[model samples]
Target: MTGTASVADMDQLGADVARPTLRGLGARWRQRRTAAAQLRHLTTYAGRPLVALTTTVHLLAGAAPVVFMIGTGAALQHLDDGGAMPWLALAIGAFLGQQLLAPVQLVLSKAVARRVDAACLTRFTAFALQRAELATLERPEVADRLAQADEAFEQWTLTPGAAVEGGLALVARYTQLVGAVVVLGVVAGPWVALAGAVVALVARAGQTEAFFRWGQLIRGFQPLRRRATYVRELATSTRAAKEIRTLGLVDWLDERYAAENRAVLDPLWRWRRRVYGVPFLTYAAVALAGSVAGLVAMARSAEAGQVGAAAVAVQGLVLCARFGVMFPESDVKLVYGRSAWEALLEFEAQAQHDAGPQAAPTEGRITPAQAITAREVRFGYRPDRPVLDGLDLDLPVGTSTALVGVNGAGKTTLVKLLTGLYRPDGGTVAVDGVDLRDLDAHAWQRAFAITFQDYLRYEMPLRENVAMGAIEHRDDDDGIAAEVRRVGLGDLLDGLPLGLDTPLTRALPGGRDLSGGQWQRLALARSLFAVRHGASVLVLDEPTAQLDARGEAEFYDQFLDLTRGVTSLVISHRFSSVRRADRIVVLDGGRVTESGSHDELVDLGGTYARMFEVQARRFGGTDGSSTGAGDDEMRTVQA
Candidate 1:
């Protein structure tokens, strides 16, 4: 499937997918998460040196401003006390620190931003690749999430940012507060100091709640922003661009783009007004009460004639503590900042699955009743609209089974259930005679290789695009090159500037585009490469849709040869291509209508026969020229 079709499919994938109800806030506070996780992720992908240097620069630069703030505040207080002329020089030092910080922060921020952006892109993709086969990515919900990916303000990456910045600010600001307290205590009693700290926290928390809402509102609008972005990119993309102009579809798409844009963002603006207006009003009321309480305390002291220059110390300390006491606001901001992944954090769901190697059974891994079988399967993407019902299917040892269906007949859904992307609501999908639910999703997913009709054309180096087939072998350069050759793409890449090293995307410099047929060939090569790397079963779901007539014929002719030793389930709509399979199964209204050899189906005059007859009529429709199966050759197969 092209990107456009993929987007459409994903948007429509509403009920069929087995998505868990989103719940819970992160139990482990954001402050408690390892700063090392993001750092380690970046270091591993982009190299330790870059990660270290960038982190060092970022931490130091980010901390410098707060250091300047506290240091300057201390220097000012020292100057105000008329303590020493030498302190004026120290004040200039703090001014110099402030002067030096801004530009340095800009540079480090840029460096860290680039590194984290690239690193997250690489690592999350690698993470997904570890468990995500074609069937997983083929799910519409997964595509929606992937398309929604952005670099603006990832909550995970920000853990390190918050740690470095928040920690430093707290330390530096607290030092300023402590210095002020010492000088004030020498003049005034400790009661003034205590009251100031209390009020400062209340003030900071109030302000932080107001500021944090603005942040959430802004970030929450992004999914819609992405939906708009998806349209713009799809319109310009290589595949969809052709159809967009030819079908005069730019306006239709632009409207959907505008609609989703409005829908996603409309909430942000509405919530922004409420979050900003109410919080500020509430904080203003709170701030008024706090100021009155402080004033009343001072007024009583003044009435008692206990006020003196020491009063100066009490008032100055309050101001100083208020400036420094923005700590709890930072904490509150931190919590609200990750509203989305709050569940992951609160749940402390950190230990990742260790994907043990999937053990392929000795008997071609298909005991008929053994591996990856669906029994009494029932599913629906929507209420009262069951797609697949009572479907009992099993693959015996060492065989190729092809699923033939018209559009929306649940061919893709079957693949998802078998591959463990979606779970059946009513029945079970079993692998190695164990229900998939009983097996680890990660390990179970790791066992199969699948190429969807909508397989990705990665905008990476030519070799890396092929390497995605079985990513464990990504470092195996020889294997990557061999797969490139095996897929008949050697000639295609040979003439490029750097062969397999040449970027497969024309969007970049020194990059190139692949024709539809070539991309299909590359996707096929990827699935085959996985087989070579020990994928027990191969699934090709409408894998020939990108191919032209000739490429389809060539692919069909080589299909059995390509999958000779592997158990295969090929889902296709084209009857001619699937007829040679050991068994051909037809689905109608989401139930298996027929299953047999082509000859048996043709003789039965059932659903398969009706479909075959309908397709056969395409041979000489309107015009007298025949373009379908040859008369005797077709008859022999049908017989």
Candidate 2:
């Protein structure tokens, strides 16, 4: 028997499964590497005009610094030489370098961000699209990484990426710092060493706080922001709106969401305050040192009759110290940003690469054959409890087989195993005699057409829903019109504003919706469309539960005619609906416990026999009772 997997377990498992995927704990180091690689990758323009253009812009920006530095020195020299024109011209050029570089830098950053954002999303979505089911998505560790990407992927490149901002900020500050050193040497040589020492010390302190803040935001603080986003979705999204209003949950949800968001922000905000405070204190320290150096330089140069040069030198040193203090702070922020980007890249790599446990092969298709078989299958969602205890069953190809079972008897799991939707914990599930795991997944999936018990009613055109069953060839296939007619949905299709193309959703304007039975017909049509397009295996998994008695009888009676050359596996909880199958097998606790024709089972008085007898009493005679199933006739019980 299966161990009860709790609601919490199922929901939390996805995040747990995802946690160790990008296994290394060195997220900081990894982020720096990923950030560098991404920037390098984006900047790598091939041998062409584009590369030349990129180089040209950067070269011009670099040249501006030299021009400005020279201009500043020249202006100071001219003022000392008592030449007004030289001082005015050099001073104007100095300011021009400072002004022109700002806007050009902004444009380049914006352009690079756009490309990087697009590239990251395209790569991650490609990885996610390869997953076979939502089961893996349930793991929260993976969900967290996935959520990080979902939350920050676009921002990594599109938004003011910490890396880009930090990188540019560092470069700008460093350039100014170097220029200040040169100007100070020319103006106040005595105080140059003192200014450099003070600026470096302030920069080191800012870097330390930045490192701590990055980790805090990425792990401890980020989840609260994600929780807030979920709250917003619940409060306003269309699906949640009705529930929000009906249960009087609007204010409660709003408050909860607000609380969760604040929980995340409060720590970050406090940390930010601390960060700013430390900088302010450090900035004051740098200023105090600058002031002492300035006073000494001023007294000495004035006494030596060089006040103008001394003033320029002191001002230049002050500017360098300020820019230097900014350098390490920016570096830490950039590295933190890089960490977020690396997380996204690591998750993408794992999702795309983890195919070892799946059913698909790296080779050819599994042979199409005359039977499906499960040999000694033992299975469970988790390893601790056994859901299927060495179960075995076989269904001949080119014939219809029915599986009947009570709830928790493992009917649905059996269907998933048979369809290659899941792998057995022990033994193998086989199609046409070859084990399902050995077959290529793409081909294996293409071989079967299934109408699940919970089949989707997609909000698309009627024809598109049917065509989805035969996805690849849907564009050129017009014979779906005939299948629509066969299912008696022809009127529904024709009566719509647009034949076959009418949107089957109540949410859309002038669109129509389907009742339970009508949608079953559409699902049936989807199955037929699959069969028409070369699917040999057809599976009906209790989706016909909504069908009236006559509708079901018509389906069973014309079963072979409808299926023709297909291999059909039918699942029904009600034995009467499935009694006509060539064989009926009873599943209990995930194993095939009984097998025989319906009449034979009834005589044997097994699970199938008891279920048959229960429904048979409803008809008032012998076989089973279902409205308009037949007039005093029972479906055959084959042996």
Candidate 3:
């Protein structure tokens, strides 16, 4: 009725009433297969003995319903004889057995499901974290799929135990139907049981189709759900709480949330209209009429002395059990369970593909000894807009080098490349003339201790916070305390309630949050802690930006002492702060425009000299002596 098939359309449609329905069935089957495989895999984590125990108990529970029906029929038959009290007792016992088993089955099902969930979540989360490239984690598409996969096991009704219960229910119901048919054939005829089974199957198919449609609607709502959640978080989040109130955007966000709700619900309403307006009502009417007709036919046969009261009773019970073979909740679970597995597998494959190839080092790995050199290295987030084009640089062993660049001049990108978070698109970054790609990335990374401009504040104990940088020394309280003292946090330790063991954030009970400057100092301590753990190179990317002028000067002096013989590359835009480096390189438009010590650069009177002069003047140093203006004057006089 939905589509009038012409000859050509019939060819396309084949024999199915709805092509989409057939496709849905196929997809559902595939998903079920995937879910079954995953469930089997989950059993490994759930322990085989527990699974077997639960499964055995569940099978016994499944037979209880059929046993109750058969026992009741026998009791009804013996009631006419007036002496078979044991049959009545058997019937009552079977009924009580079903009731008793329900709670035990429910508890066992939940226990199995929870164990499976824990195991699956752990495996999938580990899979997500194992991507070799950082870029794969940043993709929004990948994030969306990952979120869906993560949500799969959270729904109780969609759990593995529930899915198994659904299958067992089918088997139980069909078993009852068989017993009913044999009983009916002895009393009335086989036609009555046959008619009932046909009607029940048809009715079940209709009900399942409706639920499958509902499942599809739910799937479509996922994006809207994500959007609504994001908007709601913005409305209620601490980070946006002040701005939301100040900007008076409460009503606006409320309207947007409502709009998202409507977007999700409107199409669902239309679908409901189609489902209930005619087709569902017709299905209900036909099923009800057919079932009533069958019962009436059995009653008439009894009146005519062709069937006994037991036959009529058994036929009714069998009809009820047949309808229980499939249910809306079970169908929904089947559909969504499949969806979750599909999303997880798809996301894992995509993440691996997007990570590209990270081959293990083919050549023997060696630590950088002489110098780390970037020779014509190139890269960019976008293919068309290259960030580091033919960039060349060098940092010799045990010498401090400062790299100064304007914003987006590839300083952070270069740091990522050096740390092997990204691979260069052209030429090579080499350590002592060995191509970096040929060296083990992990081995190479151990040579440098880095602190970026944006550092994390781990909401953990102060000791663990600092010790995370060198995890081997995590239990070494003395080493952690020494590093904290070296970073100027020794004074604050005396005031802290738990000293090094104090939690770093108020999120935990009795925890304390640190000031911005305190966190920065802790970050420095972390880097220095790594230094104690055998890291020979230090890379600081504006790590002291949060510190005041006095603090900056004091920390830098301490830094210079700690890294006196360590190969270090300091990235900063504050010209005065980096003047103490053994050599300074100025980058402009993705290339090294100038390179020298402070005096040589001033004598050269190149880009570095101009930058220093402007910065010095801003700081009220008109004489510019601090910026090597004396070098320029002395060179001029010599000429």
Candidate 4:
């Protein structure tokens, strides 16, 4: 009874082990099928003719080895029979064909890879730009996925294009292996062929699994890799070069880079060591044993006169070919490339989820007729730390409003909400009486031309830089030139050798870099150009921050003219620059604390009044007597 119980227990354990093993195999099979389907889809991007040509080349190349082996065996048989030289000639031709087809296959494969890569890049860019809000791009998880997708363009990294090409090549290799196995079975015996094929397949499976695991490991470390990459960029990039050197941080950056790199690579290195240790040796031993067994079987058959010398030779070649195709380079490319492709798909899924349901397009453009108003608006970058809490404000049409606040007072956050880049967490932003959510986001955004505090300085031609504000009107050279002059860039334009055609960066030949003041003027000109092209609302956030005192004063002098017939919102710390605004709103503690013209606010002696008094004292202006009161208010606010 004890022995019977033991036998039953052993049987149950065997069943339990077999269950998961079978399930794992099933899962792997499904994954392979999915990979093959993806490969086929990507290949279509290469165009039918190129794909067809590439396929033909790969197949012919795969068959060359089989033809060579057969021809050599036949030639040996003919020689033994004292027959003609035709078989020998065929053998030579096959060998030459094999050699010649290799480079052609490589060239064709790369061509297909490049075409597929270009199509994938375009698709990626389109997907990234599809969302109307900036929230999706700002998420940490989405940023990590973006880094993974970006790997496709980096050197030595796997891409979807490479995966498709590798999949095709892998198929060709298996075709060759299948042909060799069949030829071996016919010439030698079924048992011998089966033994060799089993050994080769087992070894290949083990290696492929190792690589697949490595690919997954690499993918899991993408965030760490991005961190490491960022550190490396800080050490190497031109943007950080001056700061890094000036701060004497070279050694510190180097150490940081090393630490970040180790954090990413140490686990991968350990994995590689384990995989390449016992497992790799075991596979090598299995392959060697299979090769020896096959050779011995073929020799014994020859000795027994069961097969001729040619048959023995053919069987020997088949064994070598079978093992040769195992542990292929194509497996590495396919596995790693598939990981990158999967990352892109995963990003798309996550981004779609983050985007929620798409809003149906509202017909016609929604322009502000009377006012752009925020009613009890609330927003926060993080859930627990609200930036704008129940803030209410309004910008009437054809008037200028200046927003003033301390550093963390949510001035920029309010602008983002009003411009529809971010939706309020609560309440609503409205155009006239219409809620912003009801309006088409793109059309609403088009109604306003904004220049942010940190505006982009594109390194394109001068014309292209300004025309970026309204690209459809890029060819309107007269309008572009007029806007340039209107923004006080006439002298800069005249100094340029190519006028509007001069490139903005000195990195190019005949290109020139601008002074900070000139770049500010150019940025303003871009926004003004947008206004000329039908944008009726203008938003300027510290637009003159880069300009000198004279430049700032000049900008203020033209402020009314620059914003003529358009509703404008200006955000600035320079109270003097915005004193003439039709209205001034002071933001504090995530809410509007004061609203009036500059003189009215000063007379009220609130947060805005105290802030203006402090600035006036610092600049040796008139309001010296109120300095002590202003300082007391600022200290209280800071606390």
Candidate 5:
């Protein structure tokens, strides 16, 4: 029973083996199809003239060696006949042409490669921006694909340019191989040519299969590579420099980078050893045996006068040339380049899925006539942890509402949901009774002007930085200037060498970096510029955190005038700032725990009142008229 299987069992075992083989063949066919499509795509970017020229050079270069061998062999035959100058000249011309073509091919390939790379990078950037929500970008799988697509130029990786170039070279290699086989067949016999062809192809196929397996293995390590790269970046980042030096974390960071890299490489090394060892020896042995047998057969034929001197010479050269086609560099480039292309395709598919269906133009640009409301909204970054459960809130048109909460109370999360940056896990955020999901995401986001705690400090001209808020109206120079003054950045702008034209970061020539308070004001100007260009809703989250007490007070004094006709939501820890809003809402346990005017909430003596008292006591007074005390001292005084 152990030694002999029934017919049904045999059939099942055969089916299993055949299934995997068929699947492998299907995968290879798909890979080849993808490679062909990518080649055509790359050539389109490289332009027809350049591609044509490069291809012609590669083919001629590949055929040059075969021509040289035939010419030399003919020259040797003519020497016996005492007239060899023409044949010798032909041989010399072919050799020199091969040498000269090398540099020409290199230059052309580089040019084509650069153009293809630029086009691919541009497409990648466009794809990244296609997604309407931020949640998809944060997914681990998407991030891994992004990293893989981006890091195609590493030594271990292959760029699209390299892949296309390798593909061309592979075609040339086969040309050379076929030319050698044909010459051998004519000079010797069909059997010798067939044997040589078989040996070369089998060896090349085995080597190619090994490289393809290696590529597949490395693809699984993309996440590991991403983690390692992130660790490396953290160790070198300017933002983290101060903390790293203070904490003496250089060695710790180095260890972490090494650990992450090892996690990727150890398995790779083990796989290579197991996969490459025996197969490599077998290929080498086959190549060696085939070469010796073919050479010996030609030598015997020549000695017996079965073939002429020219035929003998041609056979010898062709035998050697056939093995040269088995060079592994082109194969490696093709495999790695194909892998990079596949990564890009994978990312594109995910991005399209994340973007979902596109809404019609008219239906997309919805504006709330009465209110934006959240009803029973539930959300969390992780499934097990719920951040906002059954949260309900309303922002009435043309009114200022302040949102107050302790840390981790989902104030920021709520703002994100309202702005369509993220969707709730359950329930709906509606604009004047219309669910946000039914609206065009871009148009919905464009309706609000927001300033967050961690606003981006763009290292560009100050004019461009402010104009980024509403790019279509960047030419409205007067409006830009007015908003600058409104945000209290007029003096800073006047002091600049080029005024609004001056670059924001010191990294550029003659550029200046602003202090934290000035940058905060600049961020405010950017958001206000959006309002000036027709953004109907204004959202400010810790907008004045970097400002001093006087600056904060000045901002609050102008707040009502700034947001007079816009629906506004301001999130701040300061009771003074919250008091400036028409309505104050306290967020606790993912719900609106308190909703009233600041004075009303303070009078009610609930969570908002207790928090306001604690903050006010710690600061001595909200108006900065009294000396502030430390946390422990405030607690002791209260006790």
Candidate 6:
């Protein structure tokens, strides 16, 4: 079950089929416990005063129904006597109390709900960010759980006022039922009361189970909805608009979007219909039968003089109210809320388990002043497909080394391991002879400045984007501007309206977008800024992929000049850019196949020389244009 292999296995079976296995009473108990924990956690944020006020108000309001019923019955009975006005007053007072308290409770409940939601969201997001391991975040199961928890929270926490009121009503309804049955047990008979109570409880249990089952289906359905949303966005968003039109794929994309929507919603509809069919019908049948029988028994008692007309009316009222508490809106709300709470707890547990060792390093944080070495490193994103196997590499201090490899040769994986973003499954990544696992993670990260091929576009102010590399320099405009100039963005900045303050995306007012090459330059500037901030190691994974050959060569020349004494690892497809490195290592099948200077590798005439020759011939044509024969050769070599 390590890595993504289990995720693939689960995906093949479908998330719906591989749903959580907890069942029956155990599942119900777990859900209840989760809900209780959520409520308890919310109080930490919502404040005790608000919770107390809301509970008291809702409880009073909820109990009003039963009180009003009894008051009305008593007042009606007292009509022939002189005591009617006082009884009437009692009923009116109770009614007014509910009315007066409702708006206040609702307002307080809403306020508390918002605070609780903010607290939960902030804590959950922080927990996800602060965890030391990236593997948990990379897991599909963990991701889905997070999404489900968020959805659940949003759906339920928004209507705190309603939830409070509904919960109180449920309690009040059950209390009234018990009281009614007790009265019947005395007047009608214990046997009749026992039968009615049994039927009512059975119906309630069935309805609860139905809602729980529906929640499970909805959780499983979330992935499908996400897929549908992605497809729809691709069909409609401006990013994909050009491709859709140029490729004549507008109709095709629309069809795909429609298919995705159907794929998500069709099963949902079926599940909903099925859920509302037999299980709900059974509840309805039991409820109807119990209500009718209870009413009939009450009427017979009145007719037989076993009870008064007021008593009979009270019994009937309680019977009707028993079914009233089975309101679908409230039940569904609780189900969604509880399900979310359960998911949140589940994810927290999983993340806690995945967290790295908590013990402080005995040797404290060690800076990598000498070199970083991976000895017999092993890693895999899946159980069966090892991405890096027995990888042994060294990033020597104070030198530039170029890593060249074909696709799937573990070049990027090595960079990740070296940077300590991922720990190898076996063996060791050591910095200055100290294992990475023993060093302080934050200090270890500060040792390297890395830029991956798929770098982020922050869509923030241009200054913040570069300054993010070193937060202490975030407000240092002069220093940021200096880095910008160094990266050759001075002319570009001069053209912008707000200069460094301007946002990178056109989505914001007064913002402007940069060309891909410009962004790549900005990324390099950020990395250089990190080095300026005392980072000892600089790693770039396909940093010049967006640049032309000339641009890439220029970047490499500048890179070497800027990082003259810093330990640097550069991965590039261009041989010209990589050949300038002090040392070049050719990786093939997760192992270093050749290690030497470019001339030495070429002289060896191994895989590196073959690749170099292929790329070299692409530029070595007769008329400054690559020949078709060379293209064929490249394709043949690559294949």
Best by lDDT: 5
Candidate 2 displacement at residue 20 in angstroms: 24
Root-mean-square deviation (CA) per prediction: 8.8, 7.0, 7.1, 7.5, 7.0, 5.0
How many Å off is the CA of 236 in candidate 3?
Answer: 3.1
Q: Write the per-residue lDDT of candidate 6 for residues 1-639, one digit (tens) a residue.
A: 112223234244344432335564686788667665655665567778877776676667666655665666667667776776877787898889878876876676667666766666676777677652678877766766677766556565523323333443354456556665565565556545765686667677766666666777766666665566567767777787878899999888788888877766666666666665676777778777776676666556633342234364545345743653456435765666555555666787887787657436334224567888989988998878888888888888999999987767788888888877788899899988988887766667777778888888788999998987887778878878888888778998888899889999998999989889889989988888888887888888888777765676567668778889999999876676688789999887777868999889888988777777777676793222221223344335645
User: Candidate 1 residues 407-519, lDDT tens each?
Assistant: 66788988888876666868887866777766666655555778998889898987778778777688877887777777677788678898778898888899988888898
Best by the TM-score measure: 4
Against the true structure, candidate 4 reaches a TM-score of 0.89
Clashing pairs in model 4, backbone N/Cα/C closer than 3 A: none
Candidate 3 to truth, TM: 0.82
- Model 2 Cα lDDT, one tens digit per residue, 14-129: 23322323442466458556556775554432223443443455555544554555555556556646774665576576568657866876566545444455655566676665
Show where candidate 1 strays beyond 4 Å: 1-164, 178-182, 189-199, 212-318, 321-336, 340-343, 346-372, 474-490, 620-639
lDDT for model 3, please: 0.69
* Candidate 1 TM-score, true structure as reference: 0.68
How does candidate 5 score on lDDT?
Answer: 0.77
Q: Choose 3 or 6, whichever is better by lDDT.
A: 6
Instruction: Please provide, for model 3 over 53-105, each residue's C-alpha lDDT reduced to its tens digit, 9 standing for 90 to 100.
Output: 76666566555655555566566666667744776676678778878877876
lDDT of 2 at 420: 69
In Å, residue 406's CA in model 6 sits off its true spot by: 1.5
What TM-score does candidate 2 reach?
Answer: 0.76
lDDT against the true structure, per candidate, is 0.59, 0.64, 0.69, 0.76, 0.77, 0.70
* Global local distance difference test of model 2: 0.64
The candidate, 3 or 6, that scores higher on TM-score is 6
Query: Residue 633 in model 3: shift from native, Å?
Result: 25
- Sort the candidates on lDDT, descending order: 5, 4, 6, 3, 2, 1
All candidates' TM-scores? 0.68, 0.76, 0.82, 0.89, 0.87, 0.84
CA lDDT, candidate 5, residue 546: 87
Candidate 6: pairs in clash:
none
- In the range 142-197, model 4's lDDT, one tens digit per residue, is 77777878876675347888887787776567667776777777676665566568
Q: Candidate 2 — worst ten consecutive residues by lDDT sum?
A: 630-639
